[model samples]
Target: MSATELAGTAPAEANRIGAIETRGIEPVPADERTGGPRQLFWVWFAANISILGLPLGATLVALRGMNIWQALLVAALGSFGSFALVGLISVAGKWGGAPSMTLSRAVFGPRGNHGPTVVSWLSRVGWETVNTTTAAYALLALISIIFGVGANSVLTVISLLVFVALTLVVSGLGHATLVWIQQWATYLFGALNILVGAFLITKVNWDAVAHAPAAPVSVVVAGIGVIAAGTGIGWANAGADMARYQHRHVPGRRIVAAASVGAGVPLFLLIGLGGLLSAGDGSLASASDPVSAIQVMLPSWMAVPYLLAAFGGLLLSNNLSVYSAGLTMITLGVRARRVVAVGLDIVLTLAGGIYFMLIAGDFYGPFITFISLLAVPITAWVAVFLADMLFRRHYDPRGLMDTGATSVYWYRGGFRWSAVLPWVAGIVVGLLFTTASTSATDVWFSGPLADSWMGSNGLGWVVAFVVAGGLYLLFGATTARRLGGTSSPDPTTRPGARTDGEPAAVRP
Candidate 1:
């Protein structure tokens, strides 16, 4: 078969597209693998150190009545657990040099993996739309304030196209350029945000923070859930996408530490900043836009740089989302080239951004809904992936990436009931328990469980990981070693199977 014929939306080998990102889902050849734990950290930081997490923190204060300190604690709690998983998934990247979701084929059958890939794709698109809309709005606001241009349909459309074009171009250029941009952009944002944080510190009213009516304990718990769900669970699916480029022998500890610290710090600090802002002077509470709201406290010179950072952060956020979306586009069984898959993703981002901005009466309502909705299945999938890595120790990126029907991942006509069933169950649990009240809409799709107890703190995603992990362990204990057990290879095992962690002493 031709190399092109063997790939799923494969990019041509040895053919450099905009910059050097020649590899697709195929295992990264040892000679081509580059970077280390620090790169993963910065990659995650660049993607995260944005104005996005501020709103999540603000929601805790504005809607849940959380104090700044309380919000900080909960935000830390959120970022702490989520980024740790990012670390774990980064380890998976060392073992399997493929796109993050492609590893789902190792858990689910190639065909069955489609279900999770679809979820990943939907989530990336949703996030891309959100990032694009916010960035475009920032640009429109900049032009209006700096250039005296008024906001209008034409300007909005132009700004959206501009952001879409920039992000798409960067993503289309592929990984090398994306990583370089993230490394530098994160440094810029980190420095600027520190200055803004210091300025905000001077203006903070300690009385407001200390005297703000303490939220109910239940409300506090729910607030933790909101912050954690929005910030942590949302990033679960994309963990390995960044780390897969590392050398396999690089210590997993470094990978996990770097990524966890990189992601966790911004989320903790910035969300705390938002809660602090919302608690005092009511600037966060009163401002129309999340990114620029805090700028009201800064001098013109400071605000300009802060605003630019906001724009950069948005582009970085959308750039990563689009890259992931491209990976997912290929997983949908398309045989077209990688660039074609990315183009399809760009089209979706544009269409979705325009629709939400123009037609969706309340974008934040659906945005929050989108995040909460995906948390469960994503958490569940992560649990299974981690469990497989820890106990059932084998991976086959070559098999998963194969386009031929003969691939070992084509189990039971490409469906793994063990993985799919639990994922659906977790989704049901999420639907039953997820609830959060937003200004635009109260009770954005909650079920009896949430109303009966826990308010909007829906801990279903936690339960999902526990439940799905336990079930997969059960399935693996009985089914085969290849499914995450410690036993001799079975029909599922191929000659080239990468058995990184299997030890007979721990065999099931």
Candidate 2:
């Protein structure tokens, strides 16, 4: 039986609402790839419309010491530029019809792909945890406003459960459902967000915002890197996860444009709003619970509606993360249904949300630390993957799924040294310039070059990208062209068999 048969749905019925998507890491058959670039626009737009961007903008002004104009510029460049890379990489999904990490097996080999896959999975889970905690806080604050009940340990636990359950309901239904929800939800919450934003504008101290001091050009450059790492770099790994459902013939530029514009517009506005809000009151950047912190600026009636919108926006983001994490888990060789994988990921997210909300006590410190540390490996993986895409126009779908010695990607005991070595070298070099700190006074880890401009500005991820991508292009381009040619027959016709016709022993 074909992979789609195993998924228990006809091509027509595959992505319908209320259907639980049982497909694992299998490359989506061409018939099932029906969506256009517009779908991608909605997917990315809904995913980023959350209130989280506000805190990011506030961080720019309060922590990075950028004025409002500088913050807006940084927001535009960082969010659009980073997601443009995301859009570029998403083109691979249209070619392979597989999840991002699954397509990565073509470059990294099956066994060697595990390291980056693990990091990608962890990043997804971490983001889900953060979203869950934030949503739960919004719920608690809403309850406190409605019922006159303050947050307690019990309320915290209950709130977390509520948010997690809501996420599971949408994510567990899978792709068609998520796509549908993302579109309609974007319309509803996007309008509500605009309404709330209009109210927020009245609260901004325009005089304070206008008079804010401009920082040095060096600070602005550093600010751009920080915002990029926090916003789009964190999302770089999951670019192809959603695009897997897009039609193979969809123009790559359209894909890129969809993702970049869909995400960038809202992020630019929200982050700028955050900078504006922070100019009047800098507390949002430092608050232990940001949902509660922002409430002080709004009236009681607007507060309830705003918090509800926040909760819904967070749900939108969390469900997407959970869905993608489920796919990543399957790509990591988990032997279970996709919904089962989603449940497992959510359990970890729940634990993390509990600990962070009840135990950690400090939010921004740990969040900044998390973004700084993980950005290196994810960026390194992204670099190698994008560089591989330069010469490798087609993915041998059978080779992507085949783990046996017969697979073309079974290079050198299932490790593509050319790609793997560059990836590792990138991470190592990136870390040499990385310094992670939980607080101003507390340093978690500092590399040899931590005091240098790149280190201080958090450009280690950029260095990693350049090192890994440049090295791959220099050393691996010739081999990739010879191996990853488009001469093979289409994948749909011969599902699991090798398309290259060469004997397995002669692959390398």
Candidate 3:
């Protein structure tokens, strides 16, 4: 259907807007965007590989005692879970030509949006810190190998500084530069992983791999599925940012087509390879750097390539986190130009690196365990949003003021009781569940019957998502507004809405 038809507008009106935006028919014109299937395909492919592929591989080595094969399967499934939100964002982008946060106003209301928006911003910050530190450590390891300064503190410091400098420089280039970085990193990491995989496969004792104390194949498969589900989770949240570029030009199917080819296929290959290799090596429980396994597996002559490839692969992964972090800051109204945001990011990155250097002792498991645990609440938020978008027709945000209860807080008068009560309930329930799950891991499950039922971070997310989404639905449809929602237009989208008077994709 045509844009006007989809939006429930008349043909004449749609034609007029199309002419204005695509041609020179109207005053205050916008530039016509170029590219269709190919650009989108490359962007999606580059994004997936750089953002999730290698990191998921590395993470699998560290978590779940996954051999390469098992790790890849789990990580791939995790990616599926993550992409659930991406599917919805793609539709919103095609229909509204708005960024994800802007579209969020419809559900949260203008002022009420601070909840999710702030969470996104802060979450990205933490991710950035983690990425920067990890990349620096990887690079430092490579430098140590080359210079014969194995485990030198000074080298580590120097690598940390370099990461800070590079991230800040790239931040000034804004989205376009970041996109370029992702593409370049994707190619680089792909080459590296291939080399690593080849070396490791050659070195493997097939008999040892076959005999490793095998978890039930089904358990391993299910674990692989779990990891895979979480792999592309961030892509869903960030899809609108990328899709905004496409929606202006390409058709919807083309966009979805690009996502499937670009993200889905390559990711499966990379993570699956990593998992298989990890499964073959029974040392997954203690392995932090999956690439290191290949190092031993490879001949001495191959060591240089393996080390360089490892550094490049980790660096590429870090670039995604930095880019995403910067974008999240922009959405949060960081008030600085792209360069300024980069500068702040550099400072944060260095601080994080230093913190890691000081705090990292003999154990890595505790840190990842903590991060995974803390990530539950955020994942819960994603799950709830995904549920509403997929199952309910009433939650559509294509047109009208999408800001439901959030609108009441930001633009309209009066508190949205529906949101407040549900939010509180979700938070309390989420906290209780997280605590219970942590205790359960320590073998402490004694609690009230209901509390016992709520154990596990995964379960906590389920509770929070259901409660929050249910509340939003109730408030949006029933009560004061009735099922139709308040017809009164939201002020956020009004001509009076705030703007920095700058384009969305501005460079520094």
Candidate 4:
């Protein structure tokens, strides 16, 4: 369908203002926004209710030796904590009415902001690539089950292309269409998950649940860290992308709840299910590759529909990732339409996913690498980011939108050392405690915390937040952030920006 047709089909209430979502990086004008916090809940809730979450939880069960309850507890703790950050950053959505990365320009400065933007872009693409790959894996497995043609190298390639095609079409249609699609997709996912969850419940072995491997205290702590990093810190960079188009008067608390509960519930549930399935004596329990075990669960009749929903659901998941990726690209001074930028993401996804699928073995290593590597730096960045919001109590959305001489963010050739220096420090500190392995391990700088108290793999979240936030306070992120530009009142606190504005990406 044409983009016009897609937009036309959306509910009138959603598009009543007739805001053309063409301006990718600009602050949204007040008149253009048209939603309350309720929309945010559905957007994130639907996105999280996918098969993508299973591997994270399943790994915790089989690899970390966590019992079902322990895995669920860790998963819930992480889900609650990380998603809170997602909610905190989501406040920028209503404040700036622009992409979250663009709003970040205020903190990082224009040129310096590009660093995080690129990092955000790469990280989203990495996760999206993994999402697509998992969908491809499941879809191919279904094809194998039905046709009796084994899922092979050729089918894997085919499934990926099919997945990529779906994401491009949905995201290419842009925001309003994407939102509309997610609402219905979420309903479908919820229905399907209920069926799957019930099926899994009947198959659980309570004996194994009782006798599952006992985890060390360090392992339990690390597991909580891993789950927290994966679920909580996971949403840090993308919060504003989801909520930016919310009506300005929507209470901050509501937006926070919308983003937090939206993603957190599904993550905790799905991961818990994976852990439960792994711990049981069901068909999945003895499977050599637990991540691939979801394939065998469906009855013959439900098989195709489940696969269809799973693949369709992947597009729902990838849409926002690609959408934010495009916005991040635009924020980094890439000049392109959001649709075109998403097209670029498709190209990269194609290359990256294919390359990884070919040479990758034991997804255990890659998944940990992907999540842990990105988790810490982002935690540090968000730490400083949240602290900036708290201390400054204001951000001029104009500075993010303007990107010109008078803008307060235009400092030191568009680089703010206050933010970036501390962020870099946080990254190094995070990595100091980070260990490189297929599974979570400790490295040189694992610190006395790990030496005496717990294992080091998941400690970056706390360390980064504290170090980066403290450094920013010392660097005067609040009092004096720029050398070349004079400070002003928070742009968002003021009723308006000096210039007429246009709509930008909403947080999801």
C-alpha TM-scores of all predictions: 0.89, 0.94, 0.72, 0.85
State the displacement of the C-alpha of residue 305, model 1, in Å, after optimal TM-score superposition.
2.1
lDDT of 2 by residue, 270-385 (tens): 99999999995789988777887788889999998799889988899898899989989988877667898899998999999999989997876788788999999999999999
The stretch of ten residues in a row with the least summed lDDT in candidate 2 is 486-495
Query: For each candidate, what is the lDDT?
Result: 0.72, 0.86, 0.49, 0.71
lDDT of candidate 4 over 1-508, digit per residue (tens): 3222221222334332223345566666677777788888888887787776676777777767888878888888777667878888988778777677887887887777877777788888888887777777777767877789886678878988988998887777677777877888888778877776777666666788789977876787788788777766766788888687788889999988887788889888888887877774443423334336675665677666666666766777788888888888777766666678889989899877777676666444566667776877788888878876774444555567656555666666767777888888887776666654553352223443443332245676567778888887777634344422323323333233433222121100
lDDT of 3 at 452: 50
lDDT of 2 at 187: 88
* Clash count, candidate 3: 45
* Model 2: pairs clashing at backbone N, Cα or C within 3 Å: none
Local distance difference test, candidate 3:
0.49
Off by over 4 Å in 2: 1-12, 477-508
lDDT of 2 at 322: 94
Best by the lDDT measure? 2
Q: TM-score of the candidate numbered 1? A: 0.89
Q: Which ten residues in a row are the worst by lDDT in model 3?
A: 20-29
Residue 359, model 3: Cα distance from true site in angstroms: 2.5
- Model 4, position 72: C-alpha lDDT score: 84
> Number of the top candidate by TM-score?
2
Pairs in clash, predicted candidate 1? 112-414, 392-484
Q: What range of 10 consecutive residues in model 4 has the weakest lDDT sum? A: 499-508
